[model samples]
Target: MYKKILLIMLCFLAAMACSSPSNPDNTNNGDIVNGGGSGNGGGSGNTGDGGSTGDGGNTDIPWTEIAPPLPVLDEEAIKYGIDISQEDSVIKEQIRTKIQQYNKDKGGYKVIFIGTPKSEYTQQSSLAKLVIDIAEELYKYKKYKYRNRY
Candidate 1:
């Protein structure tokens, strides 16, 4: 019985392998024609434009452009003059949470930061100030929404 089952399985595998697509390389179904083009048969070779051609005529599928992702504030350097060594962990956590929430709400595409001139930053700034500055910068791009809390 086991030998018979194995023989049947091998036959099924052979049938499946033979039943595979005639053209495994051509993935674009949009360019496939009904009766095939130039009598070359249905879906022959790549049409040079990364699209494949079918039998009778061109039936290319329409495609749409995807929207670009939003931008998020970067956390690389202390742009706002916040002394990391002197800052509290709780305050840092709060700032990080706010940035994360903003990124989640507005799909982050690339890293962004609010630039501060060296002359303007004379003293060490607070993390809360940094958050506010970042929010204001994002507001210019219509990506930020104030909720009375960061």
Candidate 2:
């Protein structure tokens, strides 16, 4: 029961963090941000252009097309009952397309990327704990209004 509750809470938090605000005209300009899990790169993945669109230094160019890839479930991820799948990429692409179309329809450069914190992404002993850490980091990012200090 505890695991189930945690899973549901994780789903809720992830969805809430990913979803756009209900009010399109919220103080934030429309920005479609993309953040990657820590990988081979060293930098914090910020482009650093300060275009005023708020897309973490990204330009108006929509991200390129990507065919859905196979799910690469690691033991840690599966043990936590997480659906680590490529379907999320497809969904994100669809959302990006819609946001781009919305920007065009509105005749404005509304879509922008709100930057993420530049802190190091560390892994925890378990996927659940890692997710909790990520959630807390995201909360801090917003609460402190973190910027790319690079």
Candidate 3:
């Protein structure tokens, strides 16, 4: 009777050990035998919700190439001389023509002419002062005022 009881207990213990859950770390080594496991035959590891994947977030579409910004022209800097002497005569003439045309088109009652001849003012320091003075004088001119009003 003692031998039979011992045998049955040994068999029960063996079955319990075999049926128990496996260690998570052992799943990596393929030692785990998961029955009815989820999804594929692979172990029960979280494989995120297989959504989109690429350069732009979780998107299926490839990243769009961005175009470079258009170059901006500095009107003031282009009008006034940065290094007047360095500018080509053709370009300078074009700028001058454009300024004149702009003024003519404006046809404002008051004109504010700024800047002096680069020739007279060898030094750039007096250029701004000369421009302001000339602008004031032009503003007071009868012809300029008359043409603008008419």
- TM-score per prediction, in order, is 0.21, 0.18, 0.23
Clashes of 1: 6
* Worst-scoring 10-residue span by lDDT in model 3: 48-57
- Model 2 TM-score relative to the real fold: 0.18
Cα lDDT of model 3 by residue, 1-150, tens digit: 999999999999999999876553333233222222244545333222222232222333333343224432556434443343332443344344444555676654322222222343333334354344445665578578798997
Model 2 CA deviation exceeding 4 Å by range: 20-58, 61-150
Candidate 2 lDDT tens digits, 1-150:
999999999999999978956554332232323332223243233222334454445464554332224453554223322232323343334334444454456654222222222233224433334344445654577467755542
Candidate with top lDDT is: 1
CA-only RMSD, every prediction: 16.0, 26.8, 24.1
Judging by TM-score against the true structure, name the best candidate. Answer: 3
* C-alpha positional error of residue 55 in candidate 2 after TM-score superposition, expressed in Å: 16
Clash pairs, model 1 backbone: 32-54, 33-54, 33-55, 36-55, 36-56, 37-55
